[model samples]
Target: MTAIVARPVSVKLDQETRGRIDRLATSRRRTTHWLMREAIQQYIEREEKLEAYRQNGIAAWEAYQASGLHVTQEEADAWLAKLEAGEDVEPPACHV
Candidate 1:
């Protein structure tokens, strides 16, 4: 059998809120501390997902800048014209 160690913590809440938590814990056959811990864990997981998205955006922008090339209006028009004419246009200088 595995044994789990528990720690003591203190928090303050309004009487109504405390009553609600107590009711919920009783109905769910769980302790208020357990419910609070589960809620906090879920919140942390959500924050991690948001942070990953933010980091991916920053990395994509850096990659675009590092590619070190830009297409002007005329260049864009020429590329489009070539594509419309069914001509094979080589990739831009920045691309492999």
Candidate 2:
């Protein structure tokens, strides 16, 4: 097994927030440092997913503008409804 190396980070938290973290750590039977690290990891993962979504939206918008090819909302809704109903259906065609 490879050894994991972690660097120490310094953060100044207000008294109220520190107290809350301490209480939660005690309740969860975890160290405050572990709680903080887990919180930071979760935050990073959530933000990364959000960033990817934003980028995909921007790319789709640009593609739509360039090609003027998109399915109508009604068409999309029908396709989604069929999928939700466990029916196999082809996606709607994009229009000029």
Best by lDDT: 2
**TM-scores, each model vs. reference:** 0.54, 0.91
TM match of model 2 to true structure: 0.91
Candidate 1 lDDT over 1-96, as tens digits, reads 899987877888899998998899999999998888887789999999999999999987788788755666677788888989999997444432
User: RMSD, each candidate, Å?
Assistant: 7.8, 1.7
lDDT of 2 by residue, 1-96 (tens): 999998898999999999999999999999999999999999999999999999999999999999999999999999999999999999999999
- Pairs that collide in candidate 1 are none
State which candidate has the highest TM-score.
2
Q: Give the lDDT of residue 93 in candidate 2.
A: 91
